[model samples]
Target: MEHIPHGSPDDPNPLRRLSLEQLRRRTSIKWRAYPEDVLPLWVAEMDVPLAGPVARAVTDAVALGDTGYPAGTGYAEALASFASERWGWDTLAVERTRLVSDVMTGVVEVLKLITSPGDAVVVNCPVYQPFYLFVEHMGRRIVEAPLDERARIDPGGLEDAFRRAVRGGHRAVYLLCSPHNPTGTVHTTGELAAVAALAARHGVRVVADEIHAPVVSRSARFVPYLSVAGAESGFSLMSASKAWNLAGLKAALVTAGPAAAGDLARMPPEVGHGPSHLGVIAHTAAYRDGGDWLDALLGGLDENRSLLAALLAEHLPGVRHLPGEGTYLAWLDFRALGLGDDPAAVLLERGRVALHPGPPCGTGGAGHARLNLATSPGILTEAVRRMAAAL
Candidate 1:
């Protein structure tokens, strides 16, 4: 395969041109989690170089010693602009946006403002693992609404869960993962609208985690949950962390819909204190000036997605995978190979390729693993080959 041209959006390739040797030298969790012999595909981190604009913004801030407490709404304004241009969400209110340390942190703060301890929080199963972890850590109980046979959200299942969540007149929260993690099922606008209607009728508040919205494939459109009708009561958590590979910066935004503004205002002022000043600068640059680089990345990811399907078919035919319309993570079913419920453990111990275990994602995760697809074609193919060899 041809190498992606680094830093050029017009090149039509999105994979970072960096080689494995270069990536392995980094101290990120993705590379350092396992021994040198293991191929790490477990974490969400992408093997990509920073966008030119983002790097420049951070470097400029460092050079001037501008690092300090974050101030102003520049980050929010950039997000508003990006939303309007990218998703046609022109009514997104920049003034109503609040900054937080990260997407998950923002989610926890939002949940705390709306519900009390022991309140039920609903989630679709096989979701981003942190959703389950954080909700429980916040002194709330988790309610699973597992996806349907097609691995997409089932309206009936969601409504049932919502009803159960609100039983005994308890306030409930629904944590939605748009462009859902693990499965990579990008929820359609119609689906989101229906969800909004259901949540309204059931008196449930929806908190959408839309951090992966920017990285969706061209085949699908990312519908902002708050943009749907009847969603004025919802909250949205967004960031440049996932799309721009800036997780270490620790900055994210929490935005409230028209009806939920008061709820957001109720959040403690200290909730905003943890965001890094440099994170605001870098994320602002990403939303305002990193379009070309992001476009290039999308192109590269498009190719990688296809390449992964082909490689899996050839090397590990027994592992069933659905070609996702968004995100770089691929959900693979290893049940056909009888790898047991925790295929990831087998892959790590025998195949020497680390992957996220399926069981931890709750129901619908048995005998499965989530593979990160944001790496070079060679590495992905090799990982598949190793899995095949292990079996």
Candidate 2:
């Protein structure tokens, strides 16, 4: 078998160093879901090599056949150390964190502990599509607190949603996507503090999906929801999967704020059983030793975002892209092209380019598309070229 290199952690532009041929050979949904002719810039997966530390950790575990049920507090400890060193969040205690299979699962579990079946889950629209799916799957009604024109949390919109959500005296949980997906809007500290105050006043529980916490650009700071002054009652789900490209590893930590610890304590013990042993090993290694690689990846993503902006301007002038401050996903508005509500369908059909359709992203997503910017510069150029050709 020939060994294929996935580029080094030191690469200035890690995304550019990847081999498109090798990426095409991948069996992940990002590659397999589409036919050979279609270029996939839809899924959240990045087209880069695994970080050295992460690779070694997973490889060693498999070589030693250490695959078994997950145990110990190492994952939590690693995250705590990372949070302190990276974001000055020293209050993330290991004792207050629990292991879960993945982020969405952790979210559902937390919601179960705090709210009933008919309870409402509030979300900022043009969000990660799964929020609607998972919340509804758990028998919770979803209330949209759509982001404002700039993709930032709308204070008035949120207040209105909260009022409507709890109108029947029903328990409500705000499923916040920090450093929001698609748009890549990293919420400010003041914004989060205001949200905490609002949730407190409305008698709503806050569950932050901070999976993209570590993926922020240098221009923005990621404030942990619990780090805010009035956020002591909020819950957060943190994971290294998104930042480190370890989505297949399946491990996440559900953390409770100081005041919410008692509520988290009621969760069933078996909920922790779902995380695979290897998953814990990979995620712990990522939090503990993957910093350098992550920094490099972020640098690459920064360049890619800029490249996408330039490409869109030169080729797809009618398209509007509000460059995100975090995550490698780019939310593009194609209404100027007059493609109706689903421009992605036209792009896929005519240009053989697959971008995540906007309609599924809920209200405010019409005539929009989410493009994955975690790929090589050449691929991004080609995708825009194809899109322009389609137009």
Candidate 3:
């Protein structure tokens, strides 16, 4: 797609075009060791800014000064439009959609609405750090199901975990991540179908997080949990934030199920009805007409991913390379760095690179540092170069 030029805003830092030098400079977490010379491949935000169409939309909204509270508007309808275009599922009925603050909010709300305190919620390990916290923070019990090596979903292990949870009198829901995070292994249709089927029979709800759905690898297209037979019977939490880099904008689409997404509708006729209006406007712009920009962004990420993999193979030999199946987050096994289990701390203290300390993701996460590869290829290469030097 030809670049569409959205007139620039008058900000000192209007996120526009991406440059390797600029990306390297921009994303380096400030105040970390390694001085100005070190590169930081941490942080999930993409180096590329919003697409022109998206930029124009937000600019237009700002121009028209329609930045009021997004309440009671047809936010659901807009989200449905996006779902239809991307997923080939024509979700024409927007009534089932509710705009939450963000994907985390949706996940927390779904858990809160469906399961009571002390009820066990299942989550795969080495996941987004928030997964563990979300369950515990809600006073709910957590069922840990760690992913196998290569980071793919271990179906047998998952089923076993669920069975144990059920047998223990702790039956509830699964906090599922599509295009699985950290490792980026997108779920196979067969695997997802099996998960849904199992949850359905055992009366377990599957709250699928589809925030990173847009930038999936070409070999892997993200299939929404609700698209599966048993998913809508459960619930889905989606947002345009990760796809379009509007997380700070705070817009998310949640499909709560069955009779109007089940959970959201059953709320005593007086609950679960609030969404950010700013998110609504930004989200609609992303879903309806942000396809071309998304394609370009994916193209950039694809290049960056290859660059990183090659660097790891060549320079950082012995670092376990968990294949990136979907998202741009590359789980680098730094165990070979031989800095004990906490390479993340060593990286920060000695290596001087600010990485997401791997331990927080639980169990298997110990030796793994999740490196965000959603930057320009130049930046990724330099980041790897710096990291290799540090090691």
Highest lDDT against the true fold, candidate: 2
- Give the count of colliding residue pairs in each prediction: 1, 0, 4
Q: Which ten residues in a row have the lowest lDDT in candidate 3?
A: 6-15
Residues 244-287, candidate 1: write the lDDT tens digits: 99999989999999999999889889989999999999999999
TM-score of each: 0.97, 0.97, 0.88
Cα lDDT of candidate 2 equals 0.92
What stretches of model 1 exceed 4 Å from their correct place?
A: 1-16
Q: Tens digit of lDDT per residue, candidate 3, span 1-391?
A: 1122321333212223555344445433332333554455666776666667778877898889987776664556766766777777674356776667788877877777777887888888888888888778999877878888767778777877787667667657888888788888888777788898888777777888878888687766777767766555667777788888886677776786663365676544323335556667778877877887787677767766777778988989978886676777888888776877778777666555667678888878877788887655555666676678778
TM-score, cand. 2: 0.97
Clash count in backbone of candidate 1? 1
Candidate 2 stretches with Cα past 4 Å from truth are 1-12
